[model samples]
Target: MFSIPLVILVPSAYGRMLLRLANTVKERSDIHLQIFAAGNDWPLEKVKEMTEAGIYKGFKPFEQLKSDFQQADAFLTVMSFEKAEEPFMKTSFTTKWLDYVPYGKPVFVWAPDYSTAYQFAHQHRAGIAVSEDDPVALVKAMIDAASNLETWQAACGGARKAAETVLNAEKIHTLFVDRVNHVCRQSQDTPNIDDLKELAR
Candidate 1:
């Protein structure tokens, strides 16, 4: 059986959910998961525990991390599924998404339906979006992506297109300038307090 290599870079605070994901992946034989836990918040003891348990492959240095991502078959990014995190999840986009876009690999977005990551994945068709909180659902998404080579290739192409079009630096700069000019025009068109008072009289 051929195993698909999936790489994920973990931020400091998301370890709890990450552990759940790791454990779930461990039970599966088709997906080989490698996690790079980045930042100081991940305690050394906890890292050792997960490593010994075979769920974690240990922290990779900066250079090796880039190499691993380049070699991996696919990428994964996640947002918190908790209700308390809804506001942040909906409004903010993770830099991980941007990083994965350049890799030209399929991304598995495990997040709530309302999350920005989920919406972006759906809009671009660049990856599989699993809005369910279940780890099983995430694993199923991985299997589906690995099994369908045609769809996988299409997703890879979509990612590259997204980078060239919507995420392009020049396009973003122009959009920002246009927004600022529109705001200035709206401010100029609004009536002043003195104008309103005179009209009232």
Candidate 2:
């Protein structure tokens, strides 16, 4: 008797892909998707067309993101259509997941097992990760999340903690500054052209 509607916030580029995964649950009556995308990739007319055809409920503007996020139950983060064997899928992490974490929302990650993004979801326990190889697995993940409300709530809290500890912007900046300072010190310690010439002799 899960009554909360599952609202998934997805970029237009990812909305369709996620729909493929959601086909199993789209008509469930308790699930809804609010897709927002911008830029030349998704024109206004195209957005309208997708909705009219019932591809999704509709497209929203980026302006509505924060308000929409506040209303939504969960977030979605997906990778490109490539399968597990693709080289890029093995190492790349979708930054969208990090964005979702800071919101303290439960996320459903659709990525290959080899993807670092999938690994992060598992390691942090911030969200559920579904294997891209099995579409049914994705659907099952969604249903399980809906049924296990308490566990998902805890995951949301974990998401916020993981964001602060592992993906903090200030922490990243400090690491970058440290690397730059180390590089400068190494350059200063290196011999000048005259010293190099003498050593060669």
Candidate 3:
């Protein structure tokens, strides 16, 4: 059985989605999804239910989580399709992306088309992106990723390139400095204090 580890935070918002995917995969494939619930938001009842059902693998500390990642075949992350989350999901990137990329393991993203997760996967080709909310589609994506070594290798290579280029700290710092300098240059022609006081009056 291929073990795919997922570290999920804020279970109140994402727990159901993860359950749906896990149940579907359980019914359809030999994939074993080991869910490590992080944060304090997970309700005890839900955790108990999933734990008994063999879906929830309990929480791991940072060191243990890193060890699990090293042992796992791949990684998974998701964005909720709930309408209330759309605005935030569209603009925000998951930190899990950063966490998984460094491992060079296949990162499977199940998210809506508008989500940053999907966009990042599409942009960098760093992971498999299943834009649809269908569990079957997500299952197919996972199966494809597991079966095709060349595809995942290429994706991992793209992830490496992204880490080396756009995600590089030095490059980002340079960009920030350049932008600040441009803004300072533009502000050079701004009105003096007396002109500002007159305008306020």
Candidate 4:
């Protein structure tokens, strides 16, 4: 009975990966799939292709993102499926994952085995992480998320906790300010490198 949308908001850099994931879930009648353009650089053809294929409603911006996400049945976060991008995946966390967490929605991430985002999701119990190379695994996660309300709610609670504790904007900014202040204090106490070199000679 959860007939809302499964939303994906991406920066337009990973159109092919989005398409692959959308295609896997296109046929579900229980929910619709929507891809929202996060930034301005999305490929026009890829957008057109998804629309034509009926995998996604279309690429567009929501009038109110928070409200839109609140209404969504679930969320998606994905990384590139290419083996060449494995190094990037291993080190990076997608912004979409952070954005989705605060909404308390069940998130599905398709990422490489070594991805930090994948590991974080699994560790925090915040979302479901599927191997990017395994379409079946992605499909199964989707179905499992869609079919079970209790599990979905539990994931949402975990995601909300993660957003509040680790990814909160205030906490991150405070940490940044503290680090900056520490560096400034250290610089004030340390002798200048040029002075040290001159003294050595």
Specify the highest-TM-score model's number. 4
Tens digit per residue, CA lDDT, model 1, 31-108: 777676543245677667667755576556666667777787888888888888889999988666666677787878
Cα TM-score per model: 0.75, 0.75, 0.79, 0.81
Error of 2 at 200 (Å): 2.0
On the 0 to 100 scale, the lDDT of residue 102 in model 1 is 76
Per-residue accuracy of model 3 over 19-112 as CA lDDT, tens digit each:
7776676554468787887643446776676677676887678777998888887888899898999999989888877667777778888899
Candidate lDDT scores, in order, read 0.74, 0.65, 0.79, 0.71
Query: Which portions of model 1 show Cα errors greater than 4 Å?
Result: 1-13, 40-46, 53-64, 169-201
Alpha-carbon shift of residue 95 in model 2 (angstroms): 1.1
Tens-digit lDDT string for candidate 4 (25-118): 5666654666665433446775666677555554445556667687777777777667777788788887766667777777887777688878
Q: Lowest summed-lDDT stretch of 10 residues in model 1?
A: 1-10
Error of 3 at 187 (Å): 9.1
- Model 4, CA-based lDDT: 0.71
Q: Tell me the spans in candidate 3 whose CA falls farther than 4 Å from its real position.
A: 27-29, 39-46, 52-54, 169-195, 198-201
Cα distance off (Å), candidate 2, residue 81: 5.6
Q: Candidate 2, after superposition: displacement of residue 68 in Å?
A: 1.9
Query: Which ten-residue region of model 3 has the weakest summed lDDT?
Result: 38-47
